[model samples]
Target chain A: MKSLIDFGAVKIYIDCSVKLAERNINHLYPSYVLEDNTVPPDYFVSLKYGGGIRRFVRKQVLFEQDSKSHFKPVPENHAYASFEWGLNYVVSNYAQEFLTIHSGVVANNDKAVIFPAPPGSGKSTLTTYLMGLPGWRLLSDEMALMLPETSYIQPLIKPVCLKNNSIDIAKKWFPDGKFSSIASATAKGDVAHLSPPASSWQQRDRVAKAKAIIFPKYTPNKKMEIYKLDKNQGFMQLAENVINLSLQGERGFNTLTHLIENTEQFEILYSDVNEVKDFIEQDLL
Target chain B: MSKHKISSQQLFDLLADSQNALDLSDSDWVDVIRIFRSESVLARFACQLEESGVITQLPSYATKHLANAKLVAQRQVSSVRFECAEILHIAKNTCEKLYLLKGAAYCLASLPVSKGRTFSDIDLLVTKDVLAQTETSLKLHGWLSEPLSKYDEAYYREWAHEVPPMKHSGRGTVIDLHHNLYLPVSGRAPKVELFLEGAIETDGFHILRPAAMTLHAIIHLMLNDDLKHAFRDLNDLHLMMTEFSKQAFWEDLLDLAHKSGFENELFLACRYCRHFFKTSISTEYLTKLANMQNMNQSEIKLLDRFYALALSPKHYLVKRASANFAELVIITRAHLKKMPIKILLYHTAYKVYRSAVESLLGKAFFEKSNS
Candidate 1:
């Protein structure tokens, strides 16, 4: 089935196999996907299984964009995961008009807060918890795209990808949260995706202004601690999370300095979601 | 390199006039942009739009892609200058002059073809005697050759025109240091001194003189078998030909190619440029080239038949059934032109043997998937 998915940032045509589509229990795409075939998608992506001897054995699913295979195929069961990662790769390379920073982002009243963290930092877990608040909006779970020289950060409301133990944690935190079944024994370990709140999709076109930069570090059984970063430290840390900073050249530097100079910057070490939420709700946003 | 089918009609129209892009349907525009991106020539098209002020009139979606590509192109221009400066700083110790080549040279010297141009590695030429010293100096400055198999190392050190590509340890910048113009074992490699004589220094950046550089660009395109980038390479030729089209340029280019035994390559390049891009070639020069390289209408026609299919974007959407046959013809000819029978046979046999072993072991075992 070839369907158009309007990701807000870029519209893509996804042609997927029946089995893979069936496995996507969340119906990941919005209803408008069926109505937009008349307009060509900015990207055309396909997910198909590699046919041959592996068909009877452990099948493999190949992800292609415009019929160009950028990455090797993964096992058949990992199709959805592979597709999401492939989309990430494409956006990171092709979407250079914005200063794309690798982070978990959520917004409140048009003000965006970035949670930039490395893997195993419980970034998505915290982002999921923050959105559970009454007025929080999910900007993106993976990256935040900011227009250069402006504080405007585009909202990309994709499913929140939680890895390993964080998968169960997110599910426990939001009982009514709709999530796909877990994919086990994968490269990033057991993985699941938590669909964003309905309101996030409703305001998908909203561009949030940058208000704060938060770096979260999840320590095992550690009390929540927040530390304010100096101007130099904040700017350098923010630049480290940027995907296309090198490609942006001097404009990237100007954007970062301007952003860090205006926004409140802090690094938080937190294990408790409740404490992190209180800090974001009461002190930050 | 990725092999995909592409509709070259879009590219042909856009290369001739950026305004043609506006006439494409949204679906067709998608294919054209992706193909140009894959071929590393989107920046050129983007440049055309930006320069002609057509960029402002396109849809936001189209304008965004162009805006993004133009930024990438600008970065490449700056990056080339920085990498060249670093190379010169290190090479100045032992090598007297560092002659930039291809994309790097174009950008540093600010040539017309330099607009929206980007390339993978920086290519530099030096005196053959000082090649070892320059390599050592580069090594001391942290530009080390990537680990290659013993056979591959032997190929680069002994048979290849350039040394093993040296990459900066920290910066990850790759540099291809060349002492000669072609594979020495190919029996048609040019003497390094002849090209060096025509080198000129522009604003402290040493580059081959316009005519010699044009001939070198032609040889670089025609001698290579990689049809994947041939279309973009042809466009580069078109830009240079338009920028340097004068009686003096044609005479100087021919004289250099004749001296270097690359007249056949030059003739083929001009023929394809005219065929694909409708590049303006003076009739006087065209006749002179035909006479210089033996006049062979039938052979030229046959090569044209192959290139017509092989040189377009390798996307499957535009591929004909016979494109594969044309590619095989072009590849076989390219390999034959690049190496002697003895070396060519060894290289082919080694590749076949390795692939057979790899397949037996399971080719997927070697592939790394992004998860």
Candidate 2:
């Protein structure tokens, strides 16, 4: 039960003994090229049921890096989530080559629109909406991998984590979109994962130059409003939202400045998905 | 001495000769990167490779990691400078000569060991007579003492060489203040004055001279409790040995060790450095130190096994079977050397009890224990 998943910039070898892990791998990483397990990977991760007798009795699955326990254990049913998080953890910490951002991204014609926001800011929900649009494609739901040297945002196509009320909204909006079984009473309060369309997965390796940097805020019953942002302020905001900004240090600062200078920056306040979509189509281009 | 493991030797060779790194496979590069990152020597490796201009010859993927590491290291150097400045400001009014030790000393001295190596806490040494005043000065400057149990506090106050670590209330930088080189409870206590005799002053602060500094680094490595960061410390020794390998430096180092009654520690350091990193120590002084220390070949062979395994990088990706066992032996020996049999018994009992209570109570106790 070992599989090598090549995620363009990084590759991981996952060893799991559970069906949930396999299902998630198939559903989320549809375009990942499978390789022989013997091929050395950047990280050798294991998602398995173990954590002494108590954990075993409770049917918990722990994520391990290089056979050593890492992070905390989750229930066996959430093995996929643990594996996903473990991969994200390794990338955020070890992917020093990229300035990892906490953002959702959508691309059109290889031009990326990065939506950097804090939690509960409708980042993923907006990304899901943009991804559903005819001409737009999902680049990432979280973790915008910005290459410092190229100043290009690379795509990492994994399941978009839908949380709380958004999960229902996503299901209602995209009836055909694949959704994982609802993980109830989770840390993020009833989380579900939405698998991006197959076309996005197929283009996962496509790296795109950032065209727009949008910080989105969701407000109920509010009209869609877009505000232009100062380049220096946008740089500060991106730096603050990055996961490994300090790891890249000055180079990261320079890369971010370049990204801000080249890209159109905006702060979008929108409640309706259709109105936001119209604004992006009409004004963002 | 036990021969350095092939992988460890290969790592050193690649570090010493970046040309060798260019020949490595992607898989080998990954292992090297993981090991270097694990031991906090990625920056050191990147510095050497980039200096040699071989990093440009490496695959783009491999070079990216190196470039990123170098960037991170550059920022760390800035942080170290900032921390040092703050400490110097705190000790500005104090009359006691503030001597930077370990990583801080290396940075202050602009030694090769400082390049790309991770800086932890600020270590400052003062004369024993001025230790209390130094502590008070640090506290007055916003360094808060880390709370420890009564027994632990007493252990540090009476037996340890340094005060309990203090954290800056504002910046959260930890600082370890020492009045001596070795613990009083450790059978051998080197005279701090002997070390200060060869001190080098820069700006308002001081660092040990090359010979004394190298000796201190070796002694510090020998007295450590675990295999954690042993490779990094060994690399420090190797860098020091390589940089200050003058005949006069070695003679002065041996003389200082002899004067301080740490000849055995020096002997062990040299032997292990030679065995592990293939550090270039002249045979004349090497043989001389070995003779002066006077340990049998069999004893050296036995200790060599543990030191070799312990000094090698212990990254999970390439962890050796003997690593954990070697670390256990070294930790036990270090504990024995750090405390007398009476205190050791009580300390062991208390630790076991605390662990039991922590395990029984689970998360709450775990948080409390860590806090």
Highest-DockQ candidate: 1
Candidate 2 lDDT, B1-371, residue by residue in tens: 44233377787677656678867876677778777876788889989887888777787767777777777777777777888888888786674588999988888778888888887788889888778877898899899887899988998898889999999898788899998888888767787788899688876788888988888888788877755788889889989999998888988998999998888789999887787667887778778987898668997887889887888778765568978998888788878877889988988899888877645543233431110
Q: Write the per-residue lDDT of candidate 1 for residues B96-186, one digit (tens) a residue.
A: 7888889899888788788888788899888788999998999999999999988889988888899999999998989999988888888
Candidate 1 runs further than 4 Å off: A17-22, A31-35, A48-61, A67-69, A185-187, A229-233, B1-7, B203-205, B355-371
Tell how far residue B174 is off in model 2, in angstroms. 2.7
lDDT of each: 0.81, 0.80
For all predicted structures, in order, the TM-scores are 0.92, 0.90
What lDDT tens digits, residue by residue, belong to model 2 across residues A1-285?
Answer: 688886656678778887777776766565446653444577678887653353435556668886566576676667776677778888787677788889999988888899999999999899998898787888888888998855588887778888889988998888988887766676677778888887787777888888888999999999988889887778888878988776676777778888888888889899998887787778777
Report the C-alpha lDDT of model 1 over A1-285, residue by residue, as the tens digit.
767776777677788873864457237555653455555577778888765554545667788887778888787767787788888888877788889999999999988899987888888888888876789889889999888988788877677888988887887878888777677778899878887877887788889998999999988799999999998899889888998888987888788877887799999998888898888778977
TM-score top scorer: 1
List model 2's recovered fraction of native interface contacts, to 2 decimals.
0.19
lDDT of 2 at B72: 73
- What DockQ do the predictions score, one after another? 0.46, 0.29
For model 2, the stretches where C-alpha displacement exceeds 4 angstroms are: A17-23, A31-40, A48-53, A57-79, A149-151, A181-187, A243-250, B1-6, B129-133, B136-151, B168-172, B352-365, B368-371
